[model samples]
Target chain A: MPVVGMVGGGQLARMTAAAAVGLGATFRVLAESANESAALVTHDVAIGSHLSLPDIAAFAAECDVITFDHEHVPGAILAELESAGVLVRPGSAALGYTQNKLAMRERLSSLGVPCPRFAPVVSVADVEKFAAGSWPVVLKAVRGGYDGKGVWVCDSAVEAAEVISHGIPLLAEEFVPFRRELAALVAMSPSGQGAAYPVVQTIQVDGICREVIAPAPGLDPDLAIEAEAMALGIAAQLGVTGLLAVELFETRAGGLLANELAMRPHNSGHWTIEGAVTSQFEQHLRAVLDLPLGSCVPAGTFTVMANLLGGTDPDVFDRYIHVMAADPTVKVHFYGKEVRQGRKIGHVTIVGGPGDSVESLRDRARRAASYLRWGTEDGE
Target chain B: MPVVGMVGGGQLARMTAAAAVGLGATFRVLAESANESAALVTHDVAIGSHLSLPDIAAFAAECDVITFDHEHVPGAILAELESAGVLVRPGSAALGYTQNKLAMRERLSSLGVPCPRFAPVVSVADVEKFAAGSWPVVLKAVRGGYDGKGVWVCDSAVEAAEVISHGIPLLAEEFVPFRRELAALVAMSPSGQGAAYPVVQTIQVDGICREVIAPAPGLDPDLAIEAEAMALGIAAQLGVTGLLAVELFETRAGGLLANELAMRPHNSGHWTIEGAVTSQFEQHLRAVLDLPLGSCVPAGTFTVMANLLGGTDPDVFDRYIHVMAADPTVKVHFYGKEVRQGRKIGHVTIVGGPGDSVESLRDRARRAASYLRWGTEDGE
Candidate 1:
């Protein structure tokens, strides 16, 4: 058995700890506080900051391999750990690109991977030049941006100047009009064994992922195969040892363009916990431990996962029983976090059976999540 | 979220803790040592003995409801807790029947449940009279027996006398020519809600369960329904609030006979972790907490579970990688315990998909378990 140390203690780490128990692996999480989600469940936890090199080095000393729950650790810290002979899955070289969006776009573009046209932004002049072809342009912080944060859609140079005055490193990109968002999740081991889950269509509300449908309903089989290949190829090209989730934009032209790269388990793959033969959490562990990857075959016809964002209700457990009673087949997962308005509290998954339609499964999942969040079938 | 306290820290509690995390429930286990299976994984563990009244009382103080990982707690201690107004699922009165074999048999017989002919054995004459119509009768200890221990087969009066000479409480039963052993697992909530899993055929060697095949291949559908109904009826009649595992002997006469009773999560239901829509561990948590029970539908066509008992190899993990690589679809669950010859260390499960035969699935599961246990596919 291997001791897997994760760098962050969010829900991803919490779910990964559950998977580690089944695999007979000793899991340790380096969390920021004792009350963090993973810290509450796993026995072996080190309370520390991921940004502190000394804190991470001390935690990594007791583990066979170190991974991440979120891509927030500075690349320099991971590089230092690697220099100290610590086994860091998805090593510093690979994580560098994910930490900086400008670097990721440059690397993918150089590798001939389809992506949005982009340029580094030092001033409003750079943004104006980049937006020459389009009126509205997407300005993204070069680092530390997640869930719609640190991003602004500028309609003109005046708006761009306002965002640029914040004095944060930024990048400019073409605002591609896309039909929907799709995510291709792939896991690769150090031994070069790779496995890819089905591409899923993700629905985002205000830039936060709200729902996901596996196999991206009505997707061309050829396109799904191509997407999987592209993700696996990216993992191999980037020398990634764990999970790499490539969020893509399905353009109206029926082409796929990579939108973002997440070097750990992403929200779009949460449905795989019940929909796929092997969960992403378990696969990530196997990858980091250099063990054989489990099969990524879908377990059912369709699986719909709905994110349970906190609504007006702070105490959602009162509504939990109601949702459980209303649907016996829907699976609920909760992160041990205090609920706040619009915060991601948990998720609901519904796997479609033999005669079940994708629409029906989505509706069931949505209803359960909505009830748990707002105490209503429909989010009012 | 509610705090769930399990009295014993075995593999059952370890798996239950995994489920508890998914439901956002706080789980605590009382273990004799820090290295117990459940204690190793769960953070909130109390180093105490179930036999110690004071220790149990302290553990119960932190829990909203108390449950058992095994039926080894003394009835008197649980009774004391109940008198103190502590909430104990499968209250002492119901657990008493599971603790004493003679009492369980008598109560089932009185309830018109089909069972083997049996009587208390105060002397050799009782065994002789009970075996008048048969030879090689089964002698069982009335309490504290598991996995072939505290059980004996008496060929004549002399052997019966030798077992009785030990002076432990004993019971005599007629030898049954059973076709095969089947287990019906049912869960009931304090609210009187009941859910039954598919009947599974259990293969045993020397009274130790080795493998379980869900739905009892080739079993009559009507008989499966009858077995489920009978088990549910028994749970209600006995006032069992958590889980009741009814072990049955399908006699050569095509009738089911009650064999044994377990009021906690039993080995026979381990397959439900991956086979059923709702795992037995999760169901037990929901039942004891009086939350709505999840559906018990099979997740696939068929599922086979093979126990991984330690063989001559003291380090079974040396062979684990081989098993994981050989079959990616087979799910392995290890109970973090030291490997001792013939001791249950883990289990392997394979869920059959379309075009898969029950035999093929069984072979895959058995091969994985055997390889991990003995470093050979055939257990040579």
Candidate 2:
């Protein structure tokens, strides 16, 4: 029975807490506020900032190992804790790549991993040089970017310059025309064991993930194996101890390129809660505890997950009963966060059996999610 | 979302709390102690006795609807709460039959349900008369008994007198020469909607449930349907809301007979956690909340659930890592309770897909459970 301390209390921590209950593990989370998603449902929560070294250190003291819900803790703080002999999974050196896009790109590129051509942009001149090869370049913050925030697709140098004017550390990458977004979610143990879930296709709306389809329908078998291998390789190379979600771009040319890296459980793997034999949350705990990883086999032929983003209605539960009645098979997950427009309040997932149409599953998931958000069968 | 308050915070409440996290509902538990299984992991817990009327009242005040983890709550207490306008699912009237075996047998027999011939035993003469047609008879306490407690198989009038002399309100039943024990688990909403899970055969050791096999292998399809219909009819007839697990006796002649009833989540339905599309815990919550009951379809063709009773080892986690590695597909659920010999510490379940043998699944589940209880796979 190990005590796993998770930093940054959010939905990931909330779901992980639920998963930990089955494993007979004591899970503790450090939240910035008592009202955070994880704090609302879990018993052991320390109200503190991830940014404060003292808060993290105090929180880490009681746990056998410390993991993260989000990789937002300053690297210096993580490094300090490690130096003081605290067992931090996905330690500072590996976390640096996820915390900084520029570092991730450089490391992946050096490791011969397929990744977008990118460069650090300290000034507008750098952005201009990077975008010279392509008119519409993707500009990403070097740090503190999530859920489509701090990211800008610049059509021209003028747009890139305007974004850089905010004085945030930025990076410029050549925007590739991709067929669709894919995610390779893998977990690694300190014992060097790694397990990869089936690669899944993630649908993005305005850069925020809206839906996810497991096993990436009609994905080339060879390509799927390659993606899984690449993720496991990246996890091993980066010394990642827990879950690593490698977001990829499935290029139109039938090639794959790494897009982003998440050192903790990512939104893309949320479908695994019902789709895979071992959910990412549970896998993360096994990895962090240095225990053997569970099976990553798919439980169904196809599974679709739809994010329940808050809409005009701040009451997410207003149509919950209707949604449950409409689709009894759809599994709903709420984060216990107050609903605000465009915020990810919860998600819905539907696991399809053999001969079950993926479109039908996706439609059911979406319909339920929409009804919860808009109180209508459709999102009208 | 509605708040669900469950009295008696054992493993059942602990598991229901885990399921509650996904439904966006607030779950609070009334536990006899702060360290009860459910109280340890759940955020909202009232460390109070279910027997205390004031404690139950206070706990029920915060909940939209109240349910039970166990049937130990007094009928008078529940009646008092109901009279005061507190919403209690599986109201006292329905729970009465479950609490008192004699009442259950009498009601089921009157409802035309097949049951063992029985008579209330007020004295040794009463037991002698009931056992006049048979040498061996079954004796059960009318109330406050669980597992093997308050139950006995009496041989001859001498043994019957010993049991009846205890004078704790007893009932005499003709010994059922059954092939195996089966349980029909079903859930009913307050709106009268009902859902029945596949009939499962339960294996008991020393009158304690040891393992459960979903769908009762080799069972006649018609009989399965009949069992389900009978359970549903009983649920409606008794006005039982939430979950009703009807323990049944399948005679050597293929006839089914009612054995016992549990108005709350029962051990026989624990396999539903991983074996069914909607777990019993989640279904109980939905039914008590008056929401539409989720589908009761089996997630896999066959599932084997093996209870992990504490053995010589008080340290249950000693071999947990080994068990996880041995059977990655086996799902483990542990109650946050200290291990004591013969106490139920946890359970391990394995779901079988098409072409998977029930024997193999049962063996795997048993091996994992034994390993968790003892340090060795064979419980050596």
Per-candidate DockQ vs. reference: 0.87, 0.87
Per-residue lDDT for B165-250 in model 1, tens only? Answer: 99999999888899999999999999999999999999999899999999799998988998999999999999999899999999
When candidate 1 is compared with the true two-chain complex, its DockQ is 0.87
TM-scores for every predicted model: 0.99, 0.98
TM-score of candidate 1 against the unseen true structure: 0.99
In order of listing, the candidates' clash counts read: 0, 0
Q: For every candidate, what is the interface RMSD in angstroms?
A: 0.7, 0.8
lDDT, residue B59, candidate 1? 98
> For residues B105-190, could you state the per-residue lDDT of candidate 2 as single tens digits?
88999999999988888887888888775779988998888888888998888888888778799988888899999999999998
List the lowest-lDDT window of 10 residues for candidate 1 chain B.
Answer: B310-319
Instruction: List fnat per candidate, in order.
Output: 0.81, 0.88
